[model samples]
Target: MTDTTVRSTGRLRGVLDRIAEARRGDSSESLAAVFLLIATLLALLWANSPWGWTYEAFWHTHISFTVGGTGIDLDLQHWVNDGLMALFFFVIGLEVKRELAIGELRDRSQAMVPLTAAIAGLALPAVLFLLLNPSGPEASAWGVVISTDTAFLLGALAVIGPGKAERLRIFLLTLAVADDVGALAVIALVYTDELHWIPLVVAILGLAAVWQLRRLRVWRGGGYLVVSLITWVALHESGVHATLAGVLIALLLPVYPPKRREVEWAAELTKRFRQSPNPEYARTARLGLDRAVSVNERLMRLYQPYTAFIIVPLFALANAGVALTGETLLAAATSPLTWGIVLGLVVGKFLGITGSTALLRRKLPPGLTMSQVAGGAALSGIGFTISLFIVDLALTDDEALADQARIGVLVASVLAALLGAVVFKVAPAPEGPSMELLRPVDPRRDHVRGPVDAPLTIVEYADFECPFCGKATGSMRQVREHFGDRLRYVFRHFPLDEYHPDARQAAEFAEAAAEQGRFWEAHDHLFAHADALDRDGLDAHAAALGLDVERLEEDLRDGDTANRVADDDIDARTSDLPGTPTFFLGVTGQTPTRLEGPHDAATLIAMLERMATAASPEAPRS
Candidate 1:
């Protein structure tokens, strides 16, 4: 090739790389929603095409698996809805487990706002859906409008939501969890066929087996899979929704925060892998890393991609293929079933969530505005997945009625997206005020650890004697242990003189130890024994750490060390930091940005990784 051709190829490759990198910036929900939208459109297109009969022929095809007439059989559509969609519900169950175990739902006070909103969101929509179709077969279809398609709602938020809507997203996600729970209960209780007593008993036994397996600390994936399969088959045989088996199994999976010891073991393995680049070491490190997170989180990461990108979309293709004939459209135009679903979803969801939010305004997490809440509530009406899922179950005997219900779902979802966009446009969330650190990380002045020239820096303003700081130090320590030499950690003294009289002296002691090149040693010792920070106690700690007590005494006798500790306090006061254990993070050599909310090690490392990826030279500007 000529030089011009080679140059053009290079430019094209660069553009492609940037495009891929930019796509990485999109949330999982956004990608899932995009795929679901494509499938919905394709299904509609295929169903209306000249070969429309083939669409029905394709999904109606039988698929069976048997071991001497013992296994089950289902059509392509039933397989997608019952078999593949189980994985989707399984991922949801994992999320629910994690949240109840350690996330926002664990805190009753913190969870009440979203929980109430979700309850309202659930009840009002069903009530509205029932009001119009009060006496007919359509009234049972109330479950259709009671759920919000979380992926679509989140995708719409990503597209047209206010900038920095993480808080709003979190609020909505919490609400959606309750929505999912309510929907699943309705499916199990309100939509089951005739029960088979023996199979139901066996299903109960399977659930017990799952719970026992969890309690016994079963580590093998295959063991869980076999038992879960047995439970699912039994449930299906019992005339129950087999998808509920996913929930039963997942709810039994243990979910918990990574203990410090677990993280340390992973860090040790990672360090060994780094030192010796061997397959054995690498595998060991990977296993250790996997073990640090709970089984629930691991399974979610494993299955969520398949559920979001493939299974759910295929379900849409099988279920969403409704031909809108002129006669059908005219009938649906005046159908109360159609209007009930639309109003129940689009209007009911907005009023319920927003109204609940209004009642619990004071209980909301800080930084959430009414506009953001309203927008999120509007988006919650996009009830696509479960709406259509319920349509099939509720109107099993009437294909035409099911199609009308599907029409309502599709219409409500589109309108909800549009309505959310408009609400977000008209009442946008307020932009956050700038929060940059007053003092940048300085190698000469700050107590820096790891590589001093590391690309990422996290500066912490902590009081040595504060119990809160002691707890925060553990998280920071885990972060340091994980990142190793890739990140720099800076410690600044922000001793609250009024609260802890000895805190200032503790800071001076740490600075004095710095003069002897043992600052970090003293720092760790101080926090480990924060309950005892008097002069005699600190002197004992210095002696234990082999620091020169004479030199420490000499430094404390003087004002220079005191002045150095005071400098950090001045920076904290001017920075408007509320108290000790405040954290700021950014790229090295830039003003660090203050961290808000809980500063868990996992969250911190993830945030830093994103920052590093964006700042890397190879990642071209998009």
Candidate 2:
């Protein structure tokens, strides 16, 4: 194993660190799930009430748009399923693109566990469904069982999962993403029986045009909107589900961590706007800030609310309104179609996800025990939104069969949520997991910058190429100056190499320098020239620090240097850190407490100065 390989192996288990950081404080998932549940209840009530005839009558009402002797027409339910749901899928597509481009799924090796488990989760459900409904019209609705509604899964976890279930959430989020992709593929490939070749070709052409626009750096939303609409229409005209238009177009849109240059430019513009207080400067600053973030994130921010808060609940209202008369319920009780969906979602999902993960438990992040995996697996059985969507597609010829499947869906969702809650309430909590550093700092093994036996110490879990960590340079510089020989500062490698592609290599360079007894020098040099820490740049750093360049290069190749970095990485991840630039302050020979922010220079300096004064020899006793 090379140095890069060591870091890669460490990251393979720690990929959830990035996803957790991305969604540290958000809680809207539960609220959105509430809306979906309410809508489902309302749908049930309306379909079974004295006004039940009104339910069918209202949804069957036709709506049409015609211009230039050509137009589109569909009933109200179709409008919700085909029109509004496309936006929902578009939001999902944006998230998918974000993950594939820069999020946890970017690293194929690191993503292998969840991806494999998700495939099992998807396949086993379909197989179980087919086993029950073999060689029949009901068998075609197998797609109904192959999905987990992400919104409901998240909401259910928050309500009933363990207190500190962040790691579990991250792991399940990755699996859910893969599950969604698999479901979308089934929707595109299996459900679409008829095809219009010419319109399909036109749709492909429209997608190609959108790709070209992306390549040309066209940032205008209007330009993409016009093209996306054209592609959606063509796709709809073709026999392929129009919602797939959102997925294809979103995949073409770019996603990346904000670049340092663009961020600096945005900052400069904002500074100028503050000084000038002019409209022109304000406009420039706004544009600069917009340019700093990627198009993928911007679209997500714009559309995700509509999808989560409105479209999804509306979809539930449209699709979940099954008439549950006594006869319908009695027939469904003995229906193979109903039983297949129930077993496929609840039993198959649990067995598939939990079984696959157990076989690959070594790749799981520490503190993510099998208990939590079991609970999350049970929750993956909530196949509501896409299940109903597929029921409409697959059982369009038989309304009674569709009703049975819908009841099965409703029953499975409730069962899955209850099972998740029960598993979580009964399971033992993680074995006394602690967020404190799992490994203590040692001068011989750690990158220390001052006296080994100093009175005060600060340990930083950092990524070399993280812009936020890079921004902390001023605070660290001030601390160094203030403490001089009194404070010992330690650097531990915690590279989020998915977002910062060059960070792992830069950390390896630091390790190479450690072998040459110049780790601190290499640390400062790498941070100072963070953007240029590629292979040649690291070579330049080794040579400039009076280290043997050939030996440094050889050390990086030998993998021992990377092993040192990976050891710290494993410790950092096991501790469940918030993210890079996390700090711990403590006295020598004692466990450090994490320093919750106001991590700015002036505030930290003042706080530390007061601490120093209180601990002084001449201070008054309290």
Which window of 10 residues has the lowest lDDT sum in candidate 1?
A: 16-25
Q: In candidate 1, which residue pairs clash?
A: none
lDDT of 2 by residue, 1-622 (tens): 3344334333422432333333322558888899999999999999999999999999999999888898889999998898888888888888888777656676676678888889999999999999999978998999999999999999999888886666688789899999999999999989898999999999999999999998998776788899999899889989899989988899899776555355556666766776688999989877876676678777887787778889999999988998989999998999999999999999999999999999999887645789999999999999999999999999999999999999999999999999998988899865654656555677766778889887777888998898888888768988878777778888899998768877987998888788888887888788888887754466567778899876776676554665567656766676777788888777645676677877776766565555556567564322
Candidate 2 wrongly placed segments (more than 4 Å): 1-25, 276-280, 431-622
lDDT of 1 by residue, 1-622 (tens): 3333333333433443343233222546678889999999999999999998999999999999899968889999999889888889998898888667655576667679999999999999989988899987988899999999988888888888887555677688889998999999999999997899899999999999988988887754677899889899999999999999998789999875444355556666766766688999999877776676567756776777788899989999999999888977876788889989999999999999999999989776545778889999999999999999999899989988888899999999999999998998898434444478765566877889888998788989999889899998889988988778788999999999778867987998898888899999999999999977764477579889998877776665444575577667766764567888888888855677999887888888887877777678574222
Q: List TM-scores for all candidates, in order.
A: 0.68, 0.73
Q: Best candidate, TM-score-wise?
A: 2
lDDT of each: 0.82, 0.82
lDDT of 2: 0.82
